[model samples]
Target: MHTPSHDWITTPLTAALLRGALDVERTAHGLLPHRLPARARAQFHDPQLAMAESQPSGVRLAFRTRATAIELDTLPTKRVYAGVPPRPDGVYDLVVDGRPAGSGSVAGGNTLTIDMTVGGAELTPGPVGTLRFAGLPDAEKDVEIWLPHDETTELVALRTDAPVEPAPDPGRPVWLHHGSSISHGSFAATPTTTWPALAASRGGVELINLGFGGSALLDPFTARALRDTPADLISVKIGINLVNADVMRLRAFTPAVHGFLDTIREGHPTAPLLVVSPLLCPIHEDTPGPSAPDFSRIAEGELRFKATGDPAERAAGKLTLTVIRDELARIVEQRRADDPHLHHLDGLALYGEQDAAELPLPDGLHPDAATHRRIGERFAALAFGEAGAFAQRN
Candidate 1:
C-alpha cells in the first residue's frame, strides 16, 4: 500500500469536493455520501434503501490538479450471496478532462452475506483498503474519481502527489432522476457506465441519481426528497418496483403516482418534468408480482426470479407493467394540460420488445451492460435531442 509522505498533500472530503450526493455523513470510519437527505432518511428506513443510498452510484470526487498519482482510502461494504460465486470487487473509475483515464479496485472490505432462500442478511466487519491511480499526464486538468456504484463506500482519506482544488463548474444543467434498480445500474460494468450516468454524459448535464433497488415504490419521503433537490431537468421512472414488490394495487397506485408528481411539482412546477413508465420485463409484463427468486439454478451458480402473482389477480387491482404504463400515460396526459412543461415518455421507446429480443435481459430483469449503453444512447437522443422534451430552447 502507498503511504502518504511529506511530499504528498492530503485533501478533506467535503461537499465542495463531491457531486451527485444530497448529504455527506460523518461516520466513525469516514465520510459517507448519501443520495437522500438526512430528513428523508429519518422518515422511513429499509435495508435496501440504506444500502442503495450509501452506494454512491453517480457520486464522484471532482478537482483540478497536475498530480500524476492519486490515492483514495475507502471502507467498502461488499455484498456476498451464500452458495454462489463471489462477485468481483467494485470498480473505481477515473476520468480526466472528461475522458476515461484509468480504473482500479480495493481488495478487501466489510461483507454483507445474504441468504436468498430465507431472505436474511448478516454483516461481517472488515478493514479499510486503498485505491491507487498513477501515471497521469502531469498537466493541470480536471479530475473525477467515480466511486463504486454497487458498494457502500465510505471516504476515509484522499491524497495526491500534488495539491488539488475544487474543479470549476462546467455550467451544465443538473438532472435529478428517480427510478428502480435498472436505473440504479444493477448489471452495469462500472459506475460511469450506469445508464443514468451515461445519459448524463451524453446530455451534457450533471446527474443526481436516486435509483434505489426494490425501493422506488412511490414513497412520499422520496417525493419530498426530489422536491427539495435542485434540478433543471427531472424524471421519475415508475412501475417495476411497485409491481415486483407487490406494494400497491391499481386503486392505490394511480393516486400514489399523482401524489408523487404533485409533490415534485410543488418544488419544480415547470422544470421539464418527464414521467417515464417501466421498461420491458416479460416476467412481469402481464402477470402481477410479488416476484420471488428461483433457487433451482442456484447449484449451477445462477439465480433467477419469477412473478408469483397470478395474471387474473389484476382484475382485483393487482398492478403489472402493462397496467402501470397505461396509467402513467393517462396521468401525464391529464396533468399536461395544466402543466405545459410536463411530458411523458413510454419506457418502451428506450427498451422495448424489439430491443429486448436483440439483447435480452440476462437475469430476466435488469439490463446488461450493453443494454445499459444502448438505453443511455437512446435516452440521450429521445429526451435530450433537438426535438426532445428536455431540449434547450433558444
Candidate 2:
C-alpha cells in the first residue's frame, strides 16, 4: 500500500554481519534441540501437573528468507488451553534468518500476530495484519522461533522463510532463589521474566527458581530441593506463606528454619545463601491467620476457605516473621565463626520502607509486575551487585 524507499534493501555486508554464525531449525513442539542440547529434555523431565492436565496443545513451524524484511502471515492452532486457569503469555524471542533480529508475544484467540521488538506480545493478523520488516539486509537465511511447552496450546503454522538456527548461548550466571507464591511467580507476567528471572537477567546468572507457590514451608522436602539444585548464588524468601498458612508457632518456626538451613548447608556448605523475609503484606503482616473458615464470607458469596492452621497454636509466638528473622540472625551469628559462607538479607531491602510506602500490594497479597520489576532492580543492586558477597570468588 506504500511505496518502498530506494534504500529499503540493505547492503549484503550488513546482511552477512547480521547473520553471523548462522544456526537455526524448527519442530512441531519441543525444545530447540540444536541450541539446548544439554537441556533437550528439560521441559519433559519437570512435567508440572498444571501443564499435564491441560487440553488441546500443539506447536507450529515458521521461517523467513530476508534478514530484515519479514512478515507473519498466519499461525497453526489458536483454540487451545481454554480450560487452564492461568493463561500462558510471554514475548517470543525470534531468531531471524539465523540471527537475533527480535522477538514477539502471541495475541488474539484465533488469529495471531508477531511484533519485531524484544518482549513484545504476539499480534493477531487482520486484512492488514501481515507484518513487514523493511531495511532488511537482502540475504537468504533460516529463521526459527522457540517456545517452552509444545503440547496443550494452539500453535498453528509458523510464518517465516529463513532456516532454523541453534539457540543463542544466553550466558546466564547462576542464581538460587527460594520463596512462596510471590517468589514462585504467582502473579508475574510470565515464566522467564519473573522477579527472580528478571533479577537473574540483570545480574547475569542462571536461575534455579525454588519459588514454589504455597509450597515453601519449613519442610525438609524444601531443604532437600535446595540441597539438590546447583547454584552459584542462593536466596530464600521466607515468612508470608508460613504466616498466612499459620503452619507453626515461634518455637517450631525457629528451629524449623535452622534445621532447614542445616540440611541445605550439608549440601551447599559454602555457597552464599541469603535469607529474605516476607515482603510487606497487609493481611498476614500482623493479623493472626484464622484457624477456622470465615463462614460469614461464604454466606455472603465470598467463597469461605478452610483455615490452614490452628490460630491458638500460633498464639504462643510460635509463628511470626519477627521471631523467624530474629532466630535466623541469631543462628547465622552463632554459626558465622564456623560457617563464614552463610549470609542473611532482610526482605525489606527488596520491598521495604520506601518501596512499601510507594508501592503497595494490589490484592492485599502479592506484588504486581511493576513491583516485581522494582524488587528485581533493587535485588540486582544489593544481593547480586558488584559489592555483593555472592560476587566474591570463593
Candidate 3:
C-alpha cells in the first residue's frame, strides 16, 4: 500500500480510459476489465472461459498526460498449480509515445491454487499492490499501462504527479482477433510482447483480442460477441484448442467453423476476414488428442503436454491439426466463391517445421517468448504488408 501523498493527483478509473476490453465490471474492490461483455459471459458457465476472459490479455489503460511519475493500484489474482513451483509474477508494461518505456509487477495481491489432477481450486485473498514508473519525460504524450496477460487484475486507483485525460483516438483501423492459448499469450513474457499485440503494433492498428486460454472452442456466444464488435480487420486462428480438447469430430468441426464465420459475417460482411489454422505441433500433426499432462518432469519444476489419442483414430473422423487445416482451407475456398473479402492462412506459415526444429515449443504446446516474436513478425508481414489480406487500400 502506498501512503497518501499531498502532491499526487487521483484520477477516477473509467471505461473511456481503457482499451481492448469489451466490458468494465464494477467489483467490490474496484473496476475489472473483461474481454467478453456481460451478455456474452452470461451464456457460458465454464470456469476456464471465465478465468481466461478476465485475464486482460490485450487490455490496457490509455491516456494523455505530462506526468513524470505514475502509480497504479491493482488487485491481481495469481494462479498456482498444486505440484509445480509458483510461476513468476505477471508483468505490467508501460508504453510512452507508442514505445516501451518501463516494466514492473505488483508485489502482492490474491492467490488461487489449483489441483489440475482433481480440477479443483482454492482462492486466498491478499492485499492490493502498486506499480510505479518514475523519471518519465515531462512532455505531453500518450501513455499506456498494459495489464498482465495471464493474471486477472482489478484497477483500484490511478495516481500521477500531473493531470491526465483520455487519449484521443489514433484513427487507426481496428483489428479484432480471436484464437487459442498461443494467441492468449500463454508463454509470453509480457502483455505488449504477445504475438497479437506485436502484430497489431506493426500493422498500425488498434487491437481487440478475444484469445481465451483453453476456452477458444468456437462457441456461438463468442461468435456473436465478435459479430457485435466494431472492427475493420478481423482474424480467427482455430484448431489447437479444438484438437487438444477433443471436443468435436471432423463432422462437427467443419460445420462449427462455417457457423462461426457465418455469425461474424452478420456484423462485418465486408471486413477483411482471415481464417488461420493451427501451427506446427508435431505431437498432434497427425495424431488426435485429448492431450494429457506430462508430469514426468514435475520434480524439475517443468510440465509438458502430450497427445493421448492414436493416429489411427483419424480413420474414425478424429480431428488433428493436419485434418483441421485441410478442412479449414476447403471451407474458406468454398466460401470465397460468394465472399470476396474472406481469406485463409495456414498456421504453418507463421511457424512451420523448420521453426519447430529451431525453437521447439517449450511445453510441447505453447510457444516461448522468442517464438512469439517470430510469429508476430511473420503475421504482420503476411496480414498487414503490401498485397496481404488486410493491406490498407489506397
Q: Which is superior by lDDT, 1 or 3?
A: 3
Q: Please provide, for model 2 over 1-394, each residue's C-alpha lDDT reduced to its tens digit, 9 standing for 90 to 100.
A: 2233453432211112111111123333321211111222233343232222121111113343554554442232232221123234433434454345565544443333322122133434322112344455667555543332221232322222343233343445566676776776554654444577667657766565556555566757557656765666778887876776676777677778789888888888888987877776644545555323333443343322233443455456756555566666777788788878787777767777577668876545668778888887877788776777566732
Q: Is candidate 1 or candidate 2 better by TM-score?
A: 1
Q: Runs in model 2 with CA error above 4 Å?
A: 1-172, 290-315
Question: Could you give candidate 3's per-residue lDDT for residues 1-394 as a string of tens digits?
Answer: 7875999999999999999999999999899999999998898788899999999999999999999999999999999998898999999999999999999999789999988778899999999999999999989999999999999999999999999999999898999999999999989999999999999999999999999998889899999999999999999999999989999999999889999999999999999999999999989999999998998898898889999999999999999999999999999999999999999999999999999999999999999999999999999999998978999631
TM-score (C-alpha, index-matched) for candidate 1: 0.98
Q: Which regions of candidate 3 are displaced past 4 Å? A: none
Q: Give RMSD to native, each candidate.
A: 1.1, 10.5, 1.0
Q: Write down the lDDT that model 3 would get.
A: 0.95
Per-residue lDDT of 305 in model 3: 95
For all candidates in order, the CA lDDT equals 0.92, 0.52, 0.95
**What TM-score would candidate 2 get against the native?**
0.60
What RMSD value applies to candidate 1? 1.1
For candidate 2, the C-alpha RMSD (Å) to the true structure equals 10.5
